[model samples]
Target: MQLTVAPIPFFWSKDTWSAFYEEIAETSVDRVVLGELVCSKRLPFFQDQIPGAIERLIAAGKDVALTSLALITLKRERKLTADLVEMGLEVEINDLSVLSYLPKGTNFSVGPLVNVYNEGTLRWLASLGATRICLPPELPLASVEILAKEAEALGVTIEVWGHGRLPLAISGRCYHARLHGRTKDNCQFACEDDPDGLDVATLDGQPFLTMNGVQTLSDSYATTVHQIDQLRAAGVTALRLSPQSQGFADLCHQYRALVEGQCSSEAVLNAITGQTPEIRFSDGFLTGDRGVAMSTPPIAART
Candidate 1:
């Protein structure tokens, strides 16, 4: 199965952003959907680096695609969506409204943020020139199998969210700004301080979620270490791994090994846990269990 690196959902400096893509060009990933996917306000800081990064990745034989903002509101954001088509590379549509801006018969891809939950939605998007789609992370494997089967018939590549924190929701109100007693406009880019996102806790101090500007994400990383065989069996074409700040290149290598059958699921999970023991891993979203539940033995949920 192919591995895809999803766009960074956090606010990162231009230097760190450029360096991450430079490192990605050397990884085992086949395709990368890179652009601002969460907040459009963060785009200006690193927008200039996109062209160079795309050139480098293409030279390295990696398929690169630009991503649309997950939630487009302002007039400038709409203009940005329209301009994505002007770029020669493929556009990965995160918001459905982006379709209204694309020219007829323009080939594009769909990001997981779009609600492609059923076969009808899948077929409709394919008809509108979506060549590939990364299914939402909350989908169960049963739904994934059904959609993958339909996608195969429609000649669309199906990708599953293989790794990273699950993006739960996006809001117009900025949680980070609210936390600091500031409004969204005058927050002064507070989200940049926590590159990976600020963790939130319950009333009792139990970890609950992560806040990144207006986006809310899961506390644990959603991993597919145990579902590689199952996803491949179901005709899933690729696995999309989201960007993280630390040890990301090594994380790609580990997932690559798992995809190539060079390592067992337990071994891969063990290696990941060894590297970041404090971080929890979950496959429950795909296994029909609680979204935060982690499978013991790593392969126990294969059925």
Candidate 2:
């Protein structure tokens, strides 16, 4: 399976963002999804860096795509979506509002945040020039298999959220700002404090979710090392790995090794444990009761 690096979800300084993409351009990853997908306000911070990053990635022989905002609710945001088409790169639609602005016959990609659950919706998007789709991380294996088959018949490539924390929801309110006792409009950027995301534990102090600006993600990282065979059998073409603060390029190499049968899933988990011992890993969305359950039995036992 091809590895695709998804856009950074947290707010980072302009130089840090530029440096990350520069490092990514040299990685073994096949594709890179750039641009802001969370709060639109954060876009302007690194807006000038995107064109250069895209150019560098393309020069390095990596397919690059721009991502739309996950939640577009303002007039300025609508105008920004319209302008994305002029950039001459494939656009990954995280919000449906972008569909209204895309030129007719323009083939685009769909991000995991879009609710594409059933065959009807899948077919409808395929007809609307959706060339590829990254299925939502919450979907089960059965649904992924079905969609993969249907996507194949429709001449569309199917991708899955293969790694990183599961992005559960997006809100108009910024939790980062709230945590600092400020409203979304007047607050300074609080997300920069946690490059990955601020952990939100439950009342009993169990890590349940992470707050990254307007996005809510699972406390546990969602991994698919144990399900690589199942995903390949389902006809999945690509695996989307979200960016984290540390050891991200190594994470890419690990997943690539697993995909190429060079290493075992247990070995990969062990390697990841060394880098992020506090992280809780989960694959439950692919085979368990809920998205939070880590259900690869053999790997779990090895851990």
Candidate 3:
């Protein structure tokens, strides 16, 4: 199975972002999807570094792709989408609106943010020159199996969200700014303070969600420690691991070990938990009631 590193969903400094990719280039990951996929306002901070990052990842023998912004509204954002084709890399379409602007006959991949829930959608994207797709993180294994089969028949490659915070929703409002009593336009870059996203909790103080500028993600990292085999059995060609601020390159190594059968699922899960014992891990979206579900053991889930 191929291991892919997803673009950084949180806002990090250019130095940090550059260093992260520099480290990843030395890892065992097969592909790296870099560039902005969240707020376009954050683009200018690190956009100039992208070209060099792409060149480095490519030189390291990795297939690299550029990701489109999840929600595009501004005219400038529209132009940005229209220009991804010229990047000369696979443009991973995160928003459906990008489809209208994609250069004619350009081979593209679908990001998990776009709703690719069923065979109809899968086949439709395939028909439109989608050579690869990362299934939405919320999909169950049954849906994954069906889509994987469709991808196989259509000669498209299938990928799944393997690890990192689950991106729940994107809104026009900037929650991080609103939390500090500001609006989206004049928020003063509040999100940059929280590189991994500001953690939100329930009334009773339970860690619940993470608030990026406009995107909401799960507080617990969404992991698929046990689902690797199932996904491979279902024809998933790669696993997209979203980038985090710290301990990320190590994560790439751990995942590569798991993918290559060098470690057990429980061992990998235990090791991950050992690294950050406080945060919870979930594969419920692929195995149980909801995204937070984590009752069944790895062996049990296999059955």
Candidate 4:
């Protein structure tokens, strides 16, 4: 299976964003998805830099696609969606509203956030010009297997979320602002403080989820290193690795090694040991269990 690097879900400075993509341009990943998918307000910060990044990745022989916002509400956001097609890049629709903006017969991609739950939705999207689709991370193995088969029959590529904190939900209210006791409108970009995302703990102080502006994610990163064989057998075309704060390029290389059969899943997990002691990994969504359950064997003993 090919490796695809998803767009950064966190808020970062313009220089940091540029540097991240510059480094990614040289990674072993075959595809890259860029553009804002979380908050429409943050678009202006890095809007101008997108063209340069896309050009660099494309020049480096990587297939690149742009993403639409997960939630499209405002007039400005609607206009942004309409303008995305003008960039001449494949647009990954995170929201269905983007469908209205895409020109007829223009091929697009479907992000995981879109509710493509069954064969019907998958076929409909394929008919609507979706060349590729990243299934929602919450899907079970049986669903993935069924959809993969259907996708292949329809001549569409199917992808799965392979790594990174699971995006659990998206809300109209900004969690970053709520965390700082401010409203979404007057929050003044509180998300900038946490480059990755602010951790939200349970009442017992256990890390439960991550709060990123208006997006909510699981604390544990969802990985599929151990399930590569099954996914490949099911005809999955690619594995998407979401961007994180640490060892991202190394993560891509390790996944590449795993896909190439040069390294085992245990070895890939071992490579990430020192990066974060608090790191937790899960693959249960694909295994048909709870989203946060770690179906794979633990790499290091947790305290």
RMSD of each: 1.8, 1.6, 1.7, 2.6
| Model 2, residue pairs in steric clash | none
What lDDT is reached at residue 276 by model 2? 85
TM-score (all chains, Cα) for each model: 0.97, 0.97, 0.97, 0.97
lDDT tens string, model 1, 14-120? 99999999999999899999999998889999999999999999999999999999999999899988888788789999999999988899999999999999999
- Judged by lDDT, which candidate is best? 2
Predicted structure 3, TM vs. truth? 0.97
Residue 132 displacement (Å), model 4: 0.2
lDDT of 1 at 271: 81
Report the error of model 4 at residue 77, Å.
0.5
> What lDDT does the true structure give each of the candidates?
0.91, 0.92, 0.90, 0.91
Total clashes for model 3: 0
Q: Rank the candidates by lDDT, best first.
A: 2, 1, 4, 3
Model 4 lDDT per residue over 1-303, tens place: 899999899998899999999999999899999999999888899988998998999999999999999999999888999998788889999999999999899999999999999999999999999999999999998999999999999999999999999999999999889878999889899999888899889999999899999999999989998788889999997999999988899999999998998888887888876566568888889883688888754353221
Error at 138, model 2, angstroms: 0.8
